[model samples]
Target: MGLKSFLSRPLAAYTVRQYQQWTRQPELAQQRILQTLVRQGRATAFGRDHGLGGVRNAQEFQQRVPVRDYEGLSPYFDRVKQGESSVLWPGQPLYLAKTSGTTSGTKYIPITKDSIGNHINGAKDALLHYVHASGKPQFLDGKLMFLSGSPELEEVGGIKTGRLSGISNHHVPAYLRRNQLPSYPTNIIEDWEQKLDRVVDETLDQPMTLISGIPPWVQMYFDRITQRTGRPVGEVFPAFQLFVYGGVNFEPYRRKLLESIGRTVDTVELFPASEGFFAFQDEPHNPGMLLLADAGIYYEFIPAEQFYEPNPPRLTLAEVELDRNYALVVSSNAGLWGYSVGDTVRFVSLRPHRVVVTGRIKHFLSAFGEHVIGEEVEQTLREALQQFPEAEVVEFTVAPRVSEAETEPSRHEWLVEFARPPQDLAAFAAALDAGLRRRNVYYDDLLAGNILAPLLLTPLPAGAFQRYMRSQGKLGGQNKVPRLSNDRALAGGLLSVG
Candidate 1:
């Protein structure tokens, strides 16, 4: 038997057991996770200060701890960075996962020993679940490539520090490491362009069966490979069967990626952040990802509309309703206590609790009091693209263009880089404007009242956003273009790149 087959027997059994507990008894599993976190952390400074010692249940835990963002937890992080122990968790973190400053500025998230276990195990279960669902026990025999950040970690205040991908690489198990591609030397190359070139060169001839990475970077890899080999990805690696991706919405890139591959492959989406691995596409056919309720994190959801309120209502899994946007909060083994990861989500299923990430809390255009979210903008583009079937959007960003004088009205400005330019630019823009108005009531009202002009569309040269991100040294791996911004800073920067 092959290595994968030998390992699958036990892994499959374990996955089945865990799946039952998660789906059949979600509340009980969540309660156990909460009690474990509280009991283990009760001795820490954060625990004592937040009355974790007395937090015996979910209700008590909620009443004691207030929801906070990275800024709110900065004071505690500052102390932890200075080499303090037992501040948030039982001891100092194993390393700090330095997140991409795409949304807010850079954040150093704690990655405790316990937290890393959750990440590793959660990933394992996701893959195992895929194997179980597909009934493809030999999926692991062929080479698997993870196009991720550098594995070379640097020391910051005596603690190891690097991107979350790098940190996870440091902990990759020996058995799985044998099947993973692009040697360790190639992984540690800090320069993204240099690393991509090397990875393409090294992995082109391998029997790659599975690939995982953020969509944009994976698209870049596919482009490079096609250029180098003069063949479609599936033609180069016929054994390739699965594509695992996360960190960004897959809608815009879905058609492009599938076209590049030249065949339909099984896909699994993940919701992993610096704080924790929160959810994964458990079933291949399911639309929403199954939340990892027992994955060492206690989750809370606040209605997106009330997220900015002084004291927003925090709801547990049972309290959340379907189709309502919510800002997710978590208390985890990673030392993040009631921390808002900043992304918003909507529940599609309540029984097993599946969710789809809607957008970022800070990524919205509300310059003219017409709040436009990422979901609305993306859906609008999707509709607009449908009208121009030949066109494909490479990347896009939206910002407000405020009036320079009273004669003009403020309007939403879109900078879109298309791989395949539409036949009619004006029609595409009109479709986008109409679609946006249809999606958002406030935007419709503003258009009707003449408070805001029709949305402006500017076609950017291809690779504009890529060039901008490269200049910012955030070209790949959890770094993405902010879809909606209140100001023109990002849009201006991308336009300035000739």
Candidate 2:
């Protein structure tokens, strides 16, 4: 038998046991977790801040701490990175994981040693999930390629240089000193510079079996690999068995990726962050499971429907009801408490706490499984509009709908309001369609046939999102334009009729 089958066979018993426990006794599992977090909170920064928030302990955690978005902790996060104790949390944090924010900047999120342990635990769980699903440890053993932000530390020797690169330098993990592969270059890029070269050098003649990174990079890497090898990836590297990815949706690029690989390759979806590894797919086919790191974090769920509601019910990770959609709330060793990560999720089942990542609660879009998140869509649109000397995004909203009810499958429509209407709307829309198709195959297929009609960019009046913000009386503090909204209603009633 090949390595994958061999490894999987031995681990079958353990995987089944964990699966049973995960699928059964979810309530008891939650209660057990609640008791653990109550104790951890008392020892961590979140517990200390709870008193100020009027939460004396875990029993009163809900009452004491209110839900918070990332903008709420920006200042405190800055302080924590400077090695200062933050008012938002209990203690002095050790390191910061630099990550890009939705707005026009990168964020240095605090990551304590305790939270780092959580990250490792999350990583182990990731391994367990792969082993369980594929029944193989060889996929874990071979040379692993991580297309992630570099592990380089920012220097504080003298004059401080500030740029996206410099900010990224600060977020390198302390443990990277001992953990990273020796062959991978020590110097890495701030904006994916030298990406193609680095990938070629590190992977060539290497025993790489699994690859992990953001979806775009992976797609790009595969494309480059195919070009260099002059054949599909299967011919270049037959040993490759698994592709693990996170930080962005994989559904969009699924088809092209499968075609490039030229065979069925196991995939694992990881939900990770600079803050910590949150959740991972427990089984390959059953969406992702929110395996509670009872020892690491305090998780809370706010219903997606009530996300913008002034008074939404915030359910602790353990108390969370299954088969319902909710916004993820996190409290960890990092100074964030009751913080909303912005991603929205729906529970698939509870015994093992499996969930489907529905969309981002903030600026994001998911029309017909394209999963066009804010940053990704923004990047694509920015690149496409660069060609249009006068084109500017005044505002835009994507809504999933039935373009033609008579059609067997409904398609998507993006209602976009431009700052300066494009000189050629058809060309502009076609550019976006091309980018989306190249980036994701599902959309490509949808467009090739009429499953999804040609993307229609409906221009709206200027100041759309801004107008919605004003009407909601939510303008100015730290709000960004919503990228996607359910077709039921205009997001925050932000769309102006064209």
Candidate 3:
């Protein structure tokens, strides 16, 4: 047997066993994770300050550590950035993953030894689940190309700082590193356009079996490959059988991506944040991903409707209900105690604990009390796009247009950049408007009452969003366009572009 094939067997078996055990007793697994984190971090400043040393159970832990967001944890992060050891996690973090901030300039999320281990193990389990479910072990035999951020890092207060993918790239196992595409030098190119060119050149002829990345970036790669080779992606990489994606909902991009691939391929969705690796799609037909209960991260859920409450009730895995949107909170090995990651999710299944990412807590529109979310907008767009098969949406954002005078009507403004323009722009807008009203009762009521005008659709010139991201110094990596904003900052910026 080949070395990789031989090694994968035992690893796959262990992952299957672990997944079964954790899913079968999710509450027990989570409790054990919570206990481990509290015990391990008891010596840290945060641990002592929060009295984590005496916290023996989930209830006690919850009572001790109040739920916090990035702003709430900023004080401790400031200490960590100044090289403070044992401030949040034990000892110093190896690196800090920099994420785009809403108010602050940036968010520095710690990456400790234990947390990195969780990241690696969670990724492994995701793949093993895919293999086990599909009964396809040959996937390990070929190269797996991951289009991610550069591995090149900058030192901040003697700690490495860069994109999470870049940080994780530095620790790729020797055996598996050989199977991953895009050389180290190419990954660190910094210029996304140039980096993509190099990636395409390097992997054009490789025996690629798996491809993983954010959907938008992956679609860009597929488009470039097809353009250069004068052949579809399936023809270029017939061995490519799986496409793993996360960071954004796949619904809007699914049709265009499938058209690029020119054939059906297995897909796996992951819910990974700078905070932690939380879940992965395990079953082939399941829309929700199975939550990773034993990934060294304690999970908590607060209803999205109550996220802004002064003291919202926090629910553990056992308490989370199916089909209810909840804002996720995590206390992990990374030393983020009761940290809100800003994402919202709804449980699809309670038996094995699976969830679908509904939207971000901050990325919703509620100007007219309609309370439209990212999921709703994306689904509405997806249904709208079906009417115009030739039109492909590359990027989009929405914002409320409040009236300047009492006589003026308020409406929702949509800025959409399309790779392929539609034949009838007005029809596209009409379809989107109808879809939203049908999906949201509040929106329907507002429109029926004439309190809001028909949604406005502005087709942006190609590369408008990209230019904006570049101008903002957030062109690549995990940075994405805010899908829905209650304010006009993002919308105005996009509209200002020629």
Candidate 4:
């Protein structure tokens, strides 16, 4: 091994050792962070208004602060965006991550110097954890491709503002700069299709070993490269070994992604957001991510079922039980307090507090009170796929449909695009419907009572979802289709193109 590779393993081992200090006793780590956050919050305008100065414990903090969504917190956010200091956190924020919101329009999430450490470290440690466990550091020797947003950032209120991925691009470790792929000009193209074309041209001949992106976007890159070279991605670049991804569920696209590569590779799953980098998968064999409890963010949870109620209990890490769904909440050094990040998670292990992202608190099927969630839909679809190996899903979404005739539209319409269509369409639909009923008790009750018809599958032409995403200007870079909806907005859009 060369100097860098020789040094990396020891460094990784040391890093993993340091990480254990927190994960092994997250309750202590979390308590320390919460106390620090309270100290910081006491100096801000929001803290004073919320009576945070007198808070001495988690119970007091919980009672003092009410849970807030973006809209509820936007008043304080407005002051920060307009160049005010000490509005939320102490002093001015270093950056404001711009993200699209379904209800709040555009959101400007603060990224303080302190909070930025959480993002930068989580990403670096993800690789370090892999090196420490696998003892393979040569993946760093070859070109690493991170399919992401433009690095070009604009100024808002004297703070750098851009998409989170673009902001993160600026911080790829200096040692890895030479190993990173897709020229700067190619990344800043903005238009995703153009960027993909340029990325393909630039990386076609390079020795790419690590490729990273949201699944569908990376799959698109693989498709274009394979089409051009008439070979599997692994053949085109045999050095390729690590696949890093986040932003959405990876299982749905796993089959197609593997098929395109023609080989298995190491995959790391990340739970990231504009708010904070919450967790990352350490062990590839398991389906859970190690929660970043001490990374300048204090976590709290409200049982997912009680989340919509008037006053939901905010439970600490020590109080959370395993295998139960909870709406994940956070109070961070970024100046966001009692922030409901719209994500729901289930604890798989409490020893180190590993969690699986179950679904969004808002993204569910409840028009007829069926309460079907993303996890249920995705899991049901996976079971159905196993029953019919000939069928392959490219993309899919579920939306409720309203109809006058009982024989008309099915209550839950599943819009799907297939890479390999099933020969027995009726049988496939029956399997999916049955699997869903088995998973969701609410859906099963509705179906049995005849209050709702069985789910229906509407397969579209190949690349229809791609066309839809492209038309909506959300083709790539941290965007994914909402998996389940109570309304027909997404369903209507899909039907128009299908």
Clash count list over all predictions: 0, 7, 0, 0
**Which candidate leads the pack in TM-score?**
4
**TM-score comparison, 2 vs 3, better candidate:** 3
The TM-score measured for candidate 1 stands at 0.97
- The reply for model 3, stretches above 4 Å from the true place, is 1-3
TM-score on alpha carbons, each prediction: 0.97, 0.66, 0.96, 0.98
CA RMSD (A), model 2: 11.3
> Candidate 4: global Cα-lDDT?
0.91
Model 1 / residue 444 / CA error / Å: 1.0
Top model number, lDDT: 4
Q: What is the lDDT, from 0 to 100, of the residue 112 in candidate 4? A: 96
Q: Which ten residues in a row have the lowest lDDT in candidate 1?
A: 98-107
Candidate 1 residue 324 Cα shift, in angstroms, is 0.5
Q: Candidate 2's residue-wise lDDT over 44-152, tens digit each?
A: 4545655543444454777777777767766555555555553434555455555557552666666665665666656556666677666666654456666655445
Residue by residue across 172-210, what tens digits does model 4's lDDT show? 888888778887888899998888999999999998889
Which wins on TM-score, candidate 2 or candidate 4?
A: 4
Instruction: Put down candidate 1 lDDT per residue, 432-471, tens digits, no spaces.
Output: 9999989899999999999899988899987888899988
**Alpha-carbon lDDT, every model:** 0.88, 0.61, 0.89, 0.91
Off by over 4 Å in 4: 406-410
